[model samples]
Target: MIDASLPEKLKEKISSFSDYKIFTHKNPDGDALGSVLALKRILEFENKSSEIFVFNSIGAHFYFLPGIEEIRIQKEFKDGANSPALFVLVDCASWGRTGFPFFDFAKKEVIAIDHHPKRTDKEPLALEIIDLSASSAAEIIFALARELNWKIDPEISFCLLAGILSDTGAFKHSNTTPKALKAVSALMKNGVNIKKIADNLFRKNEFPGQLKLLGEVLARASLEPRIRMAFSFAADKDMKRHGAEEEDLSGLANLLSGIPESRFSMLLIETGAGKIKASLRSETHKGVDVSKIARLFGGGGHKLAAGFEIEGKIEERFEMIKEKIAKESASWRI
Candidate 1:
């Protein structure tokens, strides 16, 4: 049965923590940003005060959403008079992953309304609306509205729709589950322009992004029978050369899998941001747990799809990760 106490719990949480602040993961993605902003907007309607903060910086592209002007960076929150006490970290599985490093926090209750798979760091969470089977945390937020009977406005629908498209690769990835589809379905019923959200996310790559993709594909393209791996080893110079943004890194791993016989593909992108952002794909099986591979580098996601940012060089971990995949490939086959 649907949890009867959920609505009361959320309402109580909102009412009791009327002056809470909302925090999200570093390098805020659409899902993380959208979840927090959407929740913040709804809470305000209930006379609850909340602010959305990012653990790091985001770009203008991400700021294209309706409530985009409201996001405050993590550092900005610290330097200013702190918002409210009750801190709510949205779309993140754990505190460590939240990117604020627990700065001067005194909130009695912590809430995690996310869809990311629960890792070890996710322990000690006060309230977790973590539906691992859901496509994105934004999807979970929509479900939260239905289950808790919160109003779903156009802005909320737009944010969640963007997140669904972003996290699900515009429904290209296999992580797009039945619940995901249904959540988007509900949003469409609420008057969200699914196509506009799609155009914003999938169809809006800039010139530099296109160049980066072509360069990455050219530089690190590797093949092992049916498998493919593309890599881009660049520092400041290369980024300047291509003007590639981190979001451009999102779908690179799938690029390798598109070729014939390559059932899986991986992208080992060396970022100017001092981390190797990984994206993975599987043309063969939707049950293969890529999260394990991502967990090695402190990342998490669902089976058949996952990604992470490596602290060290992609070149250093490249061989080890490749060998690891080779050893585990048989188990991954459908």
Candidate 2:
């Protein structure tokens, strides 16, 4: 069931601010893009003006989503210490997750809308409409709209559905819940094209470079027998050689997680600037909580899916991951 109080509190908080800025994690996925876009539309529906901001580039696979062009890209957020507008973080809560840990939130009011597990760090600045049981942040956004009696347009419907589809892996992941499916059914009733969403997300839009990169990464995949973990890495050189972007690595971790012998899977990509992006996935049925592993490195997400970034060479990070898994595996049920 949706929390009755959250929407009311959000409505109250939003009324206090005339302008808003929406943010999501860096290297955003479908859910991050979806939820942020949908919320922008929702705010408009409420007659509230808002803008979307994100760090780095978004994947081409998501170029088909509505309102894709409006999102302002930034290398980092400028100081907002004196800004009066409220900041709404979708899909992730912590500033570190947004890839800007030092962003000034000193006296700024903030709201966090996410489906991930609660963070152990400092709490949100204002309202937090978080549902750990939600399949995706898009699902939470849809419920939020329903709770507040806000009308969802066709564009907003597509955005929400795209997020739900992206995070649920087209309803294939274990996180696919009845409520999520019901939400999809309701969104489709608004005349959104599910085929277009599916084709772009999974099949039709894949470019030659992305395919080559996938094959190369798959060939290098290594499975640790003792821990039942499948791991792989894509060097920055390889990414450049194939012309593949960060978004192309989206589903690779989930693919590795499909190995029957593996309880969890991880994909590490060297994303230049001495930084490595680690995407982690676990078999929920196997009781492997990858988020715990992510938290140890200052990242967080759902138990079955989480990620973090590190500063170093890929080899060193790979060794660190292996060691963390070896030590952490003793606590998880195989």
Which has the greatest lDDT?
2
Candidate 2 — worst ten consecutive residues by lDDT sum? 116-125
RMSD of each: 3.5, 2.1
For candidate 1, write residues 34-126 as lDDT tens digits. 778788888877777767777668866676788778877755445234444567777776666766655433334667777776666525656
Model 2: per-residue Cα lDDT over 1-334, one tens digit each: 5477878998899889889999998878899999999999989988899999898778777889899999988877775567788899899876767776475565678889988766645744687777888999999999989888888999999999999999888998887999999999999999999989988887755689999999999999989887888989999999999998777777789899988888889899997788888899987677788887788787777778888888988987777778876886576644
lDDT of each: 0.69, 0.85
Q: Which stretches of candidate 2 lie over 4 Å from their true place?
A: none
- Give the TM-score comparing model 2 with the true structure, all chains together: 0.92
In angstroms, give how far residue 78 of model 2 lies from its true place.
2.1
Model 1's lDDT to the true fold? 0.69
Q: Count the backbone clashes (under 3 Å) in each candidate.
A: 2, 0
**Regions more than 4 Å wrong, model 1:** 1-4, 76-84, 103-107, 121-123, 208-213, 224-237, 284-287, 323-334
